[model samples]
Target: MITKTFKSESTIQTLQLVQQELGADAIVVSMREVPAGPIWNPWKKSAVEVVAVSPNDEPQVRKPQPPMQMPPSLEVAEEIPEIEWDIPAKKKTAKLPPPIKLNLNPLSGQPAPVTETVRMTEPTAPSNDRYSPPALKKIQQQLTQQGVESSLIERLMELSAETLSPSTLADVEASKRSIVQLMGAELRVQKGAGAFVSNNVVAVVGASGSGKTSVIAKLALFFRQGLHKSVTWVCADTVRTGAIAEAKAYTSALGLDLKLVYTPQDLKEVFNGEQANDLFLVDTPGYNPCNEKQMIELGALISEMPSRCTYLVAPATTKEADLHQLSASLGVFNIDGLIITKLDETYTFGGIYNFARKSNTPLAYFTSGRETSRNLETADPMRLVSALFGKEWNK
Candidate 1:
């Protein structure tokens, strides 16, 4: 799909520009009021920002129609009998070089010293087993070793067998690697740390203990050092003990701006005042996805904002069911990407990989430890595949 943003003096003007640029079928994704300058700059006026989307530019594929049948016509060919006639035969002759005179005896004639010829041989390819063991069983074992679910493993192995021949699977290493690559071929990843500095607003949300505050801090550090930009830290988790304090400490140490918002109105005001900041990392209170009241509270705060990239953080150590439920419970918050936390806490990331596909969530970033501002890395396809396959190849 196609997406674009338009900013203007008012919502109507911004939308008019969006519809004009994107087309009549374009969809409105987000609309919000933003500051004309740094949020704290009193002279700056308020402006509106609008985001839109349209169908992808790709051409749709049309199915082919069956060919029409035609009437059959019969034809006959004539043949003639074969006859034999006298054939002439050719005499065989020896192929030899002209005779040369011998140096030792002037009268004697000798053929040139029998020519010595050397034959060249071609280089040989490395030999492989002519045939492999059963393809499905072998692949299933490898996928299990990588921690992929049993059901997915079975389906993948069957697809592998259909695409590959026994001889292709004979080279176990090459065959397995190809299958793993296929598994990661469609992994969708968003520009993680880099996007922080440029995006106007970003809210980090997830279940309690999912590391929302830590992720915000990590992103702040990345924005400051990695991207060489200033950051504004906002804490909307006033009800959570130690949440504001933890975020305050990180922002103070970095000499960045810190703001506290107890309500959506407070956040809107902060966004208007903090215009000078390159990025805004908002810390949200973690909730129990099973608690409907808590989920509504969390979703309410974000829904007030017109345009924000919402990141749902989840622990890497969590179970498949919990991950899916966490995403589903908070889906109302308009989640844009996923940030997987506590990678150092778990070795098997197959569930994370599998969950992304099952939920259709775009992976954002990964945190490896409890360190407030370190161990943050982008969610990369190669890295996920390398971690799963237990090797560093092609990462």
Candidate 2:
């Protein structure tokens, strides 16, 4: 038998070549397509290789010959004995035996035996070791040491190291800046006319214990002290205990006018009667988000008020889930912007990013420490980004 292998881009061409070389009866034993070179090369596409085998000419067998008798009277009968006839006789061809046939059926009590041997090897578990630098592992270990859960640490490490790898510490800072830029792009608000109003009539509304009183006082102080604008405090929080007196005292301390409002109707009546000159800082009652009545009343009050509704989101030491729920619950108020407080607490301030992303709420101001209005600053995206990534900001 003869065997041949041919490789070509076209299977039909390869078969034709094989048939041309070895007769048309050539049988195809095996065929496959395999990559030959790099994928970048246009001519390196996978091609088919065919392996073929053909039968060769069979060998002939000799036939057996009978023993030859001696030439009878060859030397006496002939005039002169032929020299060729005196020579020994050659043997005749003998017939070959029939070829043996193989039986392939197992039911016929004739089958080929197969043997298999398997060597037992130790089982190996999949490796969980990640291909990362020692610095990343150290950072993960540090976070774990600081009581951070393993799952969150793993996520943080993945976001920091794998997604944002830095060649040097400086590059790490640059990467952080880029992430902050992306975050800022998400949080950026449309640039409007100056201050929404020359004398801004801002109303701070939120749930109870959301630092509404403190935020009101801070805004009043910020306008009076920082911007030197005349500020008026409207004490609309008549529900909470001592809320009225607290607002009065804070307004008195800053030497600002304080008015009492029992309902949204009364707030509108008073505002319409009085002339609008200075900033009217309306302080609303701290309504529970879960209470439907309070939300309805607050919504009515906001709809009536002449000032812009700025929802105070005082997220301090709060979980991300709670913040998300709060943001969703208060979304009915149609809050214009956010005012985040209690920034000094909690290193993992992922809630800020969550709120900015999920709520699509732009930040207006942020208060860190409880210093009345000392640590309060206009919430700029670049500054917040720098703080979250621990990047130094240029003063």
TM-score to native of every candidate shown = 0.61, 0.57
Compared with the true structure, model 1 gives a TM-score of: 0.61
Clashes of each: 6, 5
Pairs clashing within candidate 2: 63-93, 63-94, 63-95, 64-93, 64-94
RMSD of each: 35.8, 21.0
| Cα lDDT for residue 54, candidate 1 | 62
lDDT of 2 by residue, 54-156 (tens): 6545212222222223477664231211112223357554332222121211122332221212234579999987776566565545444434335655665
Best by lDDT: 1
Query: Which one is best on TM-score?
Result: 1
Window of ten residues with lowest summed lDDT in model 1: 98-107
What is the lDDT, from 0 to 100, of the residue 377 in candidate 1? 80
